[model samples]
Target chain A: MNPGELVPAMSGRAWRVPPRSLVEVIDVEGSQTGDVFAVPTDDLEDGLSNGRTFDYGESIRLTTGSVLYSRRSRPLLTIVEDEVGTHDFLWAPCSQEMYEIGYGVTEPHPNCLDNLTASLGGFGVPAATVTIAFNVFMNVAVGQDGGLAILPPATAAGQSVTFRTERELLVAVTACAATTANGGAAKPLRVRITEGAGSPTQGRA
Target chain B: MNPGELVPAMSGRAWRVPPRSLVEVIDVEGSQTGDVFAVPTDDLEDGLSNGRTFDYGESIRLTTGSVLYSRRSRPLLTIVEDEVGTHDFLWAPCSQEMYEIGYGVTEPHPNCLDNLTASLGGFGVPAATVTIAFNVFMNVAVGQDGGLAILPPATAAGQSVTFRTERELLVAVTACAATTANGGAAKPLRVRITEGAGSPTQGRA
Candidate 1:
């Protein structure tokens, strides 16, 4: 991989991240939510499981130095550095059903699941591989009564979170399409996959 | 710390875990929730923060290999091994207000915050340091509509999760008192603080 290759993750589009690289998801404009999902190159059933990650780490909110694990309790990636400290781990990637059920949108809509599925199609990977995602810069707060409030991104422009892949895997990055829930019209996102100089397991920043 | 000292975490009781130790929370019986919280020995404001951990990890659900980071993004502990993989990081520690509001219990009830506060009182730590906790064996699910459901525990008897401390800190463990929410009467728990033979930073299973 190149040392500093930049990839444009347009609104409602997904990109496949190469392994052994640092994937940086940058919020080009404030209040844009980036949805990210991953699956091992060899198997789809062993994809990332948010439930398992929450159980093992014993937390719902994440920050730097945390490892994103697969369903089988294996390290898939590690968060080496982060500038936006708030993100959502509770909500699923938006789907057509979600738009219709939650927002009464009957027409076809661009969603994260579709973007990810199409992006992985080139690799001959099935859509089933698209499981739970790490909602970068998406703020979802849990109330005192255990209620969840999905709020817009509080991250400033140019803020980002970087992840180092721990194994050979296929990652999908999506700029979400929800306009109202995400605060405004979805904006373009910048994703950069760079080859770091040190060990991938080393925590940075 | 001894090699294998068994500390009884009696129902509704709390214990302060020592630093440089492996803290194990054991569900002596099935269907029990153990509330666990921690704070730095030198600073109360630098206590464990679930929001920060979630943001750093980039996932809400955790598993082994996940580092629980403090408010300042410093790692406080790491999940070395886990027998019961279902835990909760979304809900706050049960308090008197929660008991009154959720269950309509007006009288004083055995709560996690009170237990943790009293446990740290002898060390001159105030009750304000008691923050959110890792609810071991507690299962809370997030719905597609961004709603949270606090479910009954799915952990079986003797299932446990062990943590390796990364810094000198004080930890509090409480066997929950909500019999209904726990699926049955809350049972006693076992907490063992063992001195490891290797470096504290080593991740083990």
Candidate 2:
């Protein structure tokens, strides 16, 4: 993805947190690093099965006016606008455990869960209220012999995706799982939010 | 989410389990969920983040075909389809340590890490293989007290999210930490996977 410009959001609501919510991904460079998965707001029983994940190659590089769906086969949300490198739909996020296991506990790097928890807190969510999550960009492919294959991202910088929240939601996100050993050690990526880029309100701001 | 219709996967990657690597999530009623979050695939250091957080009224929900962006502001992936309810993007996945804290050493229930590890195992990835994640349909909001306020999910029946592997990737997901005693316990939900539902073409049977 590339750092082109900020895209606008689709439609927003006032339902508690507004029945629906949307997030715009700006890659800043043209690159696909991982995948993304999602579920519904009310139902929490189905942990991993709640989402409908996807890869970038499957569709048009996200841009202003793209619509994304969920796993249960419903119109989860819609992308209002986009800029920069395309976003990925198949990657997952990173976590503290991952750091401990991969980088070793001795490493002082913050984990995915930490960033998420902090982000949640920043969003008015409490520190202890963090819940489990679905990984996004990080790719861990399975081999024929039932093995994990950690691979590079398929997306670039400066891409984006937008959607409308179907209901009130509390969302959190992180950059790539790449680190010093990987290639993302330089700095974290940049993300932004806008209002109404799709539907009748495309590119409000 | 309601079990809309049964679309068996064209391949076993959706639900095949010689103990194939697959994750399941059941959507209870009355919540919203997100379907996708994209990030870097190899950089285990920077899991999904764009350096921004939301306020009390702001949120990101993942529905079918939805995309989750990074701090860099890019679309990592797109939500293809879903079956569960709406999803939360702010909530972090649970870990075994959480089990000890919540369950008091009674043996951790199926947590996010557990399910993810299982999913990785299907790909021959060891338990130590770590990657970033995008928590599908989790709810972690900012609170009035300037703290995290992870409210119960607003997901309903028959809602789900699906993703297509952009690049051959190995991803993992967990149901959620809000299950059973959290909120779904009042009405425990069940998640099911067919080809293309959660797992990949090489796994689901």
Candidate 3:
């Protein structure tokens, strides 16, 4: 309705979106990747399931028209618009332990898991439950033999992808803090919510 | 060891395997699927990582010569033998919430998450720490666009896959309870560990 929110670089933010509303994640500054997570308003315990979405939706590269599913297979959000098509759903959210083990970083490093857990703290969600996150603008290339290559985002400045909420949902977006998918650097992201912006769905339930 | 242990249909078992020891998972009956989990005996806090393995190993369909990495990127185990080459490392461990939400099954259902949690209870590891596990004899085919297809196990009766421990590790095996990957049924699995087995590594860090 008013000014869009900005997900500061290396941080995260969470809020609710009503049914039929449109939500957009903008790559505010080029090549800055982020992670998106959704949990139904009525069921904060249940969250997004990349496995279920891939199984039911038929692909991991979710673009326009792809329906994101809750762990229960309930439709939560549908991708309605796409300015960039390559998003990663395969990798798990990065955490503090990952930095310690992978890079021997002993200092406190901001990670998606902590950012998400803290962002969802208002809902009393714990860290472990924050297991999976749909990586927005994160490029993961799957090879013929199921090999995965974590490439940099193909997104550029001002590019954004939009989604329509199938039901009232609590969503969190993070400007991914890991150096893996953000071209070795982290940056800011933008989120805009347009109330009652999309038409109701047609056809079977 | 003398007799191999049997993970009853819908249950799990845990044990420690010494370095270079050969561990085998047998599909006791044709079409049975299983889940494999490992934690360093020293650190029960950390476990396996599908994301890290897929990144370092460069493939999800791990077979002979594939080294499984821990969450911190430490090499824990290597696949020295693979009777069934097609396996899934994509899906998260099935949980009770999954059955209730996805299938509306109200009855108490055995799941990989619970089975793993209970099995690792002996080591004082909690449920939340049992985050990721590798699905053995489980078929998850990835489409060209990263879509996933859960298919029946191609493993025949008595067919098995073997792994060599890179270090002393606490390994757990479970007879998968979910039907999505087992063709709508669950069955028993077999685990056998050979002590003081296999030759040392040739060249690896």
Q: Estimate each model's TM-score.
A: 0.52, 0.36, 0.78
Worst 10 residues of 2 chain A by lDDT: A7-16
Candidate 1 off by > 4 Å: A1-19, A196-198, B1-205
Worst 10 residues of 3 chain B by lDDT: B196-205
Best by DockQ: 3
The digit string of per-residue lDDT tens for model 2 on B1-205 reads 4352221111011122221222344344434332222224443222233211111111244454444343332333345555643444433344554455444657645555555555555655433222224555555443322123445655566444555443323344444443532454423334443333433342221
Clashing pairs in 3: A59-B147, A60-B146
lDDT at B131, model 2: 26
DockQ for candidate 1, please give it.
0.02
Per-chain TM-score (chain B), model 3: 0.94
Ranking by DockQ: 3, 2, 1
- Candidate lDDT values, in order: 0.69, 0.38, 0.80
What's the lDDT of the predicted structure labeled candidate 1? Answer: 0.69
Write candidate 3's Cα lDDT for B1-205 as tens digits. Answer: 4568989999999997888888889998878888899888877656776766765666677888888877556778888888888777777677786778667899999998888888888877655556568889988777785667778889899999988888888899999998768877889999999976866762232
Q: Which run of 10 residues does model 3 chain A get worst, by summed lDDT?
A: A196-205
By TM-score, the best candidate is 3
Candidate 2 lDDT tens digits, A1-205: 3332321121111111244444555444433332222334453211122122221112312334444433222334455554432343322244444445445666666554456555454445433223223333333343322123445544455444555654434444455444531244422334443333234454333
* TM accuracy, model 2: 0.36
